[model samples]
Target: MELIEKHEEILERRAELLEQMESRREQLKIQRTKQVEKSEAARHRNITLLQDLQKIEDRLRGRQLPRPHLLALETRYWASVEQSVPAWEHFLLGKGPHPTDGPGQPPRRTKQTPSTAKGSGLPPRPKPRTAR
Candidate 1:
């Protein structure tokens, strides 16, 4: 009889242990889900900040306002700039690299203004890279 009683007590203890373990496992799963949700929210916030920065840069370029740096502009154009205008032409306009060119080779680099103004301002044009 005593032996049977001891076995019954051991079985009850084992059942209690398994119940506790199952409860802990469920709690862990809930915590993991919360962590994943937090990470996704952070990523979304970062993307929104990047988009705002791009809009601010556009405003700084002065696309909405008239600018002295703007040469012949039809709808804020860059055709003259896009095509190969002579380096002297930029010099005549009082904006460009110093006239430096090899007799046979093209100029090594073109000149451009570095503007600090922002808020709808156009970005500075790229300087042409000529042969060394």
Candidate 2:
């Protein structure tokens, strides 16, 4: 009788241990499922953020002009300005109209005073003395 009771107790303890192991396995599975769901949600957010960043980069690129084209335009504009500046200086100095001006335009002329005009080399005559 004692042997039979001891055997039954041992069997019962084995069954309880198996049940506890199964419960622990189910809890681990549930925790793993939740972790996987969280990871998937984070992945989705990361993908969206990367897409947004790409779109912003594209827009910035679209708004910017190419460097070579901009540089060409700047060079042309400065060349035009440089060409006009010398011509304007010549005109202001009263040298003449710009060479680029057409033939129909009259030459600019400034009036000359006697001091500025070319003169023959001659001595000035003395004024006659007044009668006493």
Best-matching candidate per TM-score: 2
Can you give the lDDT of residue 5 in candidate 2? 98
lDDT of 1 at 127: 84
TM-score of 1: 0.43
lDDT tens digits, residues 25-101, model 2?
99999999999999999999999999999999999988966699899999999999988897788776767675567
lDDT of each: 0.73, 0.84
Q: Candidate 1's C-alpha lDDT? A: 0.73
Q: In model 2, what lDDT does residue 59 have?
A: 95
RMSD of 2: 16.3
lDDT string, candidate 1, 6-54, tens digits = 9999999999999999999999999999999999999999999999999
Q: How close is candidate 2 to the true structure, as a TM-score?
A: 0.49
